[model samples]
Target chain A: MPGVCASSTQSPLEGKVSKVKWPTYLSLSLVAMILGVLLVFQFRVVRYIEQGVSLGRVQELTVELRQLEKEKLKLAAEASDLSAKLQQAGQGQAEAEKALEGELEKARLLAGLVPVTGPGVEVTLDNPPANRGWATSLYVIRDEDLLRVVNELRGAGAEAISINGQRIVATSEIRWAAPFINVNLTRLVPPYHILAIGNPGNLRSALEIPGGLVEYLQELGVQVKIQAHDRLTVPGYNRPLEFRYAKPVVKE
Target chain B: MWLGVWLTLLGLILGVIVGLNIPMVLTKAHAKYLSVAVLAALDSVFGGVRAAMEEHFDHTIFLSGFFANALLAAGLAYIGERLGIDLYLAAVVAFGVRLFQNLAIIRRHLVRGIKRG
Candidate 1:
């Protein structure tokens, strides 16, 4: 049967290639081309996933952050309204008005409601040079470092403190929120500028003291810069202070 | 054999240029499905090449196999996801093994043809 088949038919198995079909060649080539395009797209998608959050998730988070910020602004306006009302009510009694005004001024200062200006020190923390290898977490500033620095400043008699223009009130929290540093719930990037209202000499000497925060941060390869200015201004806290639980005791 | 290879290469070059110029953004959730489909298509192409070398290539079979394999791979991935099982991985492993097998056969055919010449 094999011999009869070979003799009767000119088979492709005999080594003489058959004439190629143009349509089949075209279709196969088209399919291969599509596969090539898909391969590139797959590589891109994998890389994007490895780098960080998905594009859709990023967009969703951004929108949420914006909405929260708007709510914060609205609450801040309401607090200011209450403060103005309190000031107007105090105007009714002339004899006790002077003493009450003085107390109100002191309360405003402590609550970070009034902006402060004084001779103080400015500390700047920046990411280390990129050539030092990008993967190491030590080269970047962390939340704990910022907290330590703020605590040291307060200990050295800093009347007011602000990080990247966000005032650090008594209720303020400094934390790491993944790819960002959140100070008083506001997101901050690298190259942080921490301003303190205090005696310039005292603040600078406190940071530069042996085994202090500055030295510790330097050991971690973080760029730290300290400068004293004759006059510096710190903004008031922007968020509203809600006092829901505490009430002043009434004496008969 | 050389004609098919040349045609494939030309198509790839053209496809790359077109793919880069157009922005084809797929959501992150659906990226895995496309990836599995691509792998299945790749396996089918290699199988078709091996069949052609063995003198049993059929155009209809090749076309049908290409689409069917890709769709089935993607479907399996989706079903697996719904079932909370990694079904895409199964497709990946299967296609990967078959791709290597087809590649080995094609390599053997080329080497034998070279030695004969």
Candidate 2:
């Protein structure tokens, strides 16, 4: 304020225009102005150092870890309770059954009969809706296109995969039957979102590698979005398993 | 004070506003050098102000000191990095000490001038 109305605040020494010049004022004020901007930047740097993850981000991450820990505790308690019951009922047979039960649980997970949740990647595939022109179906997503993506995900060590909520197991088939793609006998509507549970880095790189399925789909006018998640839940397979002709061969 | 000093300040404010809105910002990696440069600028500004009050302000000396302090502080920090040491700490302390000393002298000069008047 004082500097703005120069004459009113001008001291006796500064009144000598012979001593004070335009350059001094210009340089000083310019330096002060630059200092203001640098101050703001320095403030930002200090803030980032103090809190790399800003407020409201830590809670959600802790929630996922908490859920996983709860499940682990539940499993351990069940194991301990079962062993105690078996000890009361008399002994070695139940011990074997307990181990077998653990194995069965793992197999059921592999068969996609149980709901699973973990860190994973979600992929969404769609066709550009605005460009629905003549012979556009030729450029649309096909069963083979989906198959290629599934194949790539599997190769990248994906433990579980689902297309449009349909889990892909050993017997699941991806097929094209005129105007729609089928996964496990269920027709899918685009945009087809595929969720794969695996190392996110590995899964992303598998699909996004140069000239890979995602790029190929893009070339065919199919839009693809791949995102990694800290906690992704895939629905359990709803279809029943039935076997009549095929029988399990037993060891002699 | 120069008549156009306000214009220089206005230009600086406008430049910062426009540039920052354009999302031009120093990243975290550049913070180390930026902090040192800021300290150097602060020292130069104080020194300049003291010289101005004593009626011996020289543009060449002021500008040269400004750039030299910034570059030398940055260079010391770089050399420290190469030698696996914290040489920038020296710049910070040296500048900090000079800053307060300059501030005290400026304050004493102001007090004497006010009492005389």
Candidate 3:
């Protein structure tokens, strides 16, 4: 360590202190101070340089991402427009096909290529001839059985269905009339006639679906059979559509 | 480097997990088929766009290869899902194929394009 003392005399201090020692100490301290100042400035310079590089890269990536996102949005808009057009075209084609199918079916019936559709199958269920006890009355078809058959026929795409010639409309009720069941307002006895009008193949398969209508009915010892005809029309149910009770209240 | 390869694999896995969880992110009524179709279409379009952009703008082998691999995996996954095939199998095969395909593309780009540059 060099002391801060210095002589003001013009005389050479060489005698008190050697020339090399004082100058050497002064030069070394000056060098160290200069280096300290440079280091502090260097730290700031390095920090700014790093920030510049990082920000430039971030900006570049951000621009690239924005452009990519814009392109994606534009392409998506175009795709949605195309999809909408396709949906409209598909719907139009489906409606036209349905109309043509109906007309063709009618024409086939007129030509005798299809059977006239009328009162569907009549199923009459009677107590087992040997099981003459009142307990055998339980053998009558239950609500679940009727529901299963109706559901199966619906799944098979039956256009119009009537149980025992009673037209099953959207609101038709099928329930037990205490000794016999009334399907679509028509009272039917055991050995029930289920008149379903649809594709015979599909209808039969639907009716015979495993663990479906057929399986349930058979478990109850009810006899089941299907007869297909080209046209079997059931009389329309007389229930009126009720919506007055469901009207929304207006908030003024 | 093998590190790059591993990173790429990790990215793909993350992308898939995130993709599967997107419905949770975006609540909307979307049929699975429709979403899958859209995903496939976007993948194809992105692959093509990336290729075109690379060829026209960057002309870089690595960037183009990444885009191509991403597109292939997305496309195969979509097709498998649509056909009712195992989606995970499709995705796995897609990853391997994409890696090899991209490597080949990179080799070609280096040999045919970068050598002169």
Candidate 4:
């Protein structure tokens, strides 16, 4: 071993004195253990960040979201079935039943349960030209603009409305979800095309009113275009609308 | 000398398996510190290997160097982050240069051993 060390080393004293001691073995092993643990931790941390998910929280949330969606669909189906049964039970009173059915249809339209088509206006809101070199804040259409436009349309007697194909139900929310606008929990990008089912003349006049939402948005440098169409179709709400707490009073 | 390598490899394998199975001890916030410390530890390991090859390996020096270097590197990184300076880059470059230098020395010793054998 000494001869081999001598051959391996440049200096002879180094060859003899640097013999591997027992304590050296112990310390090296300990260092090796630490290095090993650190390497593993580093690897795990990198993987976690890259995957963008906590150890189990993301998976748990995803499972929960899916389960809730399923429950909502089931409850919606059950509600529709009960309504149909109520309509059938009232078949004995013909005139009252017909009037009741008509009222139910109007309610369904208002509730965004059925798609509707009529003469209405389509309002398109877009960011101003990119060459303007203005800050995003200057040209971007904000959530408040969308909410005001929707309110104006409803005030103009719009029976139904849809924004970017997402039916704007009574409970639909329009707000900023960072980078995009969330309507009915669906992310929408520019340019937003808002289609309102109403009298085209009335909707256009409502928007063109002095100091109204359209003017306010235009002043903010947002491009606003309102085009009235002879016919426009608004889709039914796609998401399950479950009324968990609202129960109908039993008219005994 | 080979015994040290074997023990390190075993420890590494055991660590990986345990790390995979066990819950994470470190949080995302400490990732930068861990990275700098790992680099420092690597530099020390290579330095140890170089010392072994040169026949001047000291147990106390290697042990002290390992812990001190790791802590110092991590500390520098933490302080740099607080001070809004990238001090980990300095640690990385320094340790990286030493690691390569030690590797080169170890390689030379291995080549000499092979020729003699």
Candidate 5:
């Protein structure tokens, strides 16, 4: 059957080659060409898509967060039960101990160990959607971008600051962990929601300073949204903190 | 046999050139569907070649199959995206499996032809 093409003219009939019909080659060639084009196009498109945090990764983290929340609830219930037992045992405590309890409550509020609510400003940040579909990492929001915003807010007398609902305390950290940022040792995804308790106008103005954090981010193709709110509540620091080496000095 | 292989190579090179010169911009979303469509197209092309070798070549069926399969797969992918399901994966798997099957058939034909020749 394959020899039928050998009888035709322009068959390159010098050899016993299995000559297939020319139509087959022509059609396959066109399709192969389309395939080649798509291969390169898909390759370039994948590179751009992978440049940002993928949806699958975010979903994985969300699953982890849900599991951790369940464990946290279980732990919190156990802690409360233990605290109740201790309070029952410490009934009729001395006046000195009662006074110390009051001091501890004041310390907790000052140390950001409890949630605080007041008039403040909220700053949200995310990289602007690519306009040309070129490099994305170059214009993305970095850890330093977030730090600059936080610093500017604090400089403007923000009493309490929370990033993505993770309270910022003396030991809190805001740093980069490629493809995502970390706050208080917890991974935070964009768009970063930064809430600060302070004079709303002052906090907003601090970020709005010419060539300031907000402006700098905006220039880098980062979407920066700032709004002053009459009331904003910053979450409390939930992670346990332990001081092992530091001790108070005894005063003579 | 060698002429057909050379034509395929030439077509691929020409395709790459045209694809690069073309001003079409493929976003990340469209890129996914393109990959699946490419698989479908390759599958149809191989199926056509196989049919021709078996003495039943029909350009009408081959062309319709190529375009219709790609469009159907792409449409399925779009629906999957809106529904928040990875429905494109089904198209990917089905086309991918058929593509490999067709390639294997072509390889057997080439090997048998070489032995006979």
Candidate 6:
């Protein structure tokens, strides 16, 4: 297996060297070259395929949304028809009463005039102290905290909400930057204002709900105000909905 | 070409894992040898598949196909790895190259057939 060339032409030491070294060097170099080329080509292909897969996923989601909208319309029409029949028979008193109750609740929430309920405390978080430590500087408002607050607010039946004067929408984002946080891209600093246009009385208590974020923040010495604003108005969804990828795809 | 590419990818992955796990066995020199052998094997597989598909009927066809495929795969794979690229991407390029080559050959054959008719 040593360097035995065709026609049996090999020098003595050269034969041993070729047998032991040349084969290894040649094989290794060849493999290295091949691997390099393949890697380049494969990466390009993978990128192309990944883009295609992402597009396909978006198309699939669009189809699902269209199906859901059809179902919603069908259900709404059925409910309206049933209500009309009940009214014609003069047997819609209970339904009418319920509707009135709903309207009254809405008006109260709109005026921010609801009483607080349950046992909860409020702790408004302030900017880091002037003599803040390194850790405190890094303790800026994070996306997780904003998400937590929103989840808790919804759970507490918060009728409406606003952060730093900007109304919270379905697709609002609370992005964090250096020392500042954004509520739908509007920047604000401590003491961060978060207005809940709900039953102020209920909201005061909701803010202090046990096993809640407010309690945790209070322990951390964050300042929180839970005052009942008799005439606080939670601004409506004023921001336009911008769907980068959620638009319906019309199939030809 | 496609088969060759896939084989190369499989070989590359195998080589990487084996090289990492058995570091004791992977002398720089040994690694080099393994790289070449793996690439060659992958290429040979592709050539064999192509020959089978085309129904080429020479004695020693399998040996010849294997040698040719191995050499081609090794050549392409080396180019890919040197560029810090992925084996799969390399395989894709190899496939494209092979496809184009075959298409050209087929076109010539078709033209020749038309002339005879």
Provide the lowest-lDDT 10-residue window in model 3 chain A. A1-10
Least accurate stretch of 10 residues (summed lDDT) in model 5 chain A? Answer: A5-14
- Predicted chain A of candidate 2: TM-score: 0.61
Cα displacement (Å) at residue A231, model 3: 3.0
Q: What is the per-residue lDDT of model 5 for residues B1-117, given as tens digits with 9 covering 90 to 100?
A: 688779988988988887776666676668888877777777777776666555555554565677777777788898999999999999899878877776787789889999999
TM-score of chain A of each: 0.60, 0.61, 0.43, 0.58, 0.59, 0.44
TM-scores for every candidate against the unseen true structure = 0.47, 0.43, 0.31, 0.42, 0.41, 0.32
Query: What is the C-alpha lDDT profile of model 5 across A49-87, one tens digit per residue?
Result: 778567788789999999999999999999999999888
TM-score-based ranking: 1, 2, 4, 5, 6, 3
- lDDT values, one for every candidate: 0.84, 0.77, 0.52, 0.82, 0.79, 0.53
lDDT by residue for model 1 (A1-252), tens: 212211101122434233558877898889888887888778777776778686788899999999999999999999999989887776756647877899999999999988999899999998776775666555678899899999999999999999999999988999999789999889999899999999999999999999988999888888999999999999999888888998999998
- For candidate 4, the iRMS in Å is 6.6
Model 1 alpha-carbon drift over 4 Å, by segment = A1-19, A52-78, A89-252
Compute the lDDT for candidate 2.
0.77
Q: Which candidate gets the maximum DockQ versus the true structure?
A: 4
B24 Cα displacement, candidate 4 (Å):
1.1
DockQ of all predictions against the true structure, Cα-based: 0.13, 0.08, 0.01, 0.17, 0.16, 0.02
Native contacts recovered by candidate 4, as a share?
0.44
Best by TM-score: 1
User: Candidate 2, residues A1-252: lDDT per residue as tens digits?
Assistant: 222221111223433323546676666556566766666667667666666653356667788789989999999999999989978777777877998999999889978999899988999988655555655555678888888888999999888899999999878999998778888899897899999999999999999999888888888778899999988988889898878888999989
Which model, 1 or 6, shows the larger TM-score? Answer: 1
Question: How close is chain B to the truth by TM-score, in each candidate?
Answer: 0.91, 0.83, 0.32, 0.88, 0.85, 0.35
The parts of candidate 2 lying over 4 Å away from their true place are: A1-89, A132-138, B1-117
Q: How does the DockQ of candidate 3 come out?
A: 0.01
Model 1: colliding residue pairs: none
